[model samples]
Target: MPHLTIEYSPNLGDFPEADMALALNASVCASPEVKDESDLKTRFVRTRHFQIGTADTPRAFVHAQLRLLAGRSPKAKQDLSERIAAVLRRMAPRPDGTLVQLSVEIVDMDRPSYVKESLG
Candidate 1:
């Protein structure tokens, strides 16, 4: 776990982002590359107008982007993505009137570097 961006609809309410971050960190730590929890970084963004018309009322959608700074492997990325997705799915509310959607994308740091220092 290095950097994780969790984007969701503003309708999610004022939930505990910190708790989510911690859970994500713990999940990543289960991986080999995530040797230290200190190396993890996380961010949550709640935006409005992120609706799914196909779904019924009371909809909720969430997109998660996870960037790993170490131990970049295809298996690792797949595993992490699935794990994160599962976690988010369980944590997210149901689409009673709210259509709940969740997706997770994992990025490997070994290739295509995009760190702050590299950006310059």
Candidate 2:
């Protein structure tokens, strides 16, 4: 299972969260580490209270977190992370006078404790 979460500043000015999620989902699906694209899920959360560097200047940031089942090699994770970072950098809003910071992180889910039950 791969879950992608995007946390970003609210002041970014009408960001297209839905489209961004779709693009990221595609990016995740492109990774060789992922088994299935249908299982990929992505969501975005806007943060209203946050400071970057100096409070006086208008600074923004987007942080992407990807969680997947454990057992992938370090190279696989790094590849996925780099792909995601590229997508984020390309999609993130660049408001005229604001400095935006982009970052990506990959998290591993413990296979022993992780559980999933689907009902369809």
Alpha-carbon RMSD of each model? 3.8, 1.2
The residue pairs in collision within model 1 are 57-97, 57-98, 58-97, 58-98, 58-99, 59-98, 59-99, 60-99
TM-scores, all models, native as reference: 0.76, 0.93
Strongest candidate by TM-score: 2
What is the C-alpha lDDT profile of model 1 across 19-50, one tens digit per residue?
A: 77778778877877677767667888878576
lDDT, candidates in the order shown: 0.75, 0.88
Clashes per model (N, Cα, C within 3 A): 8, 0
Task: State which candidate has the highest lDDT.
Answer: 2
Runs with alpha carbons beyond 4 Å of true place in candidate 2: none
Query: Which consecutive 10 residues in model 2 have the weakest lDDT in total?
Result: 48-57
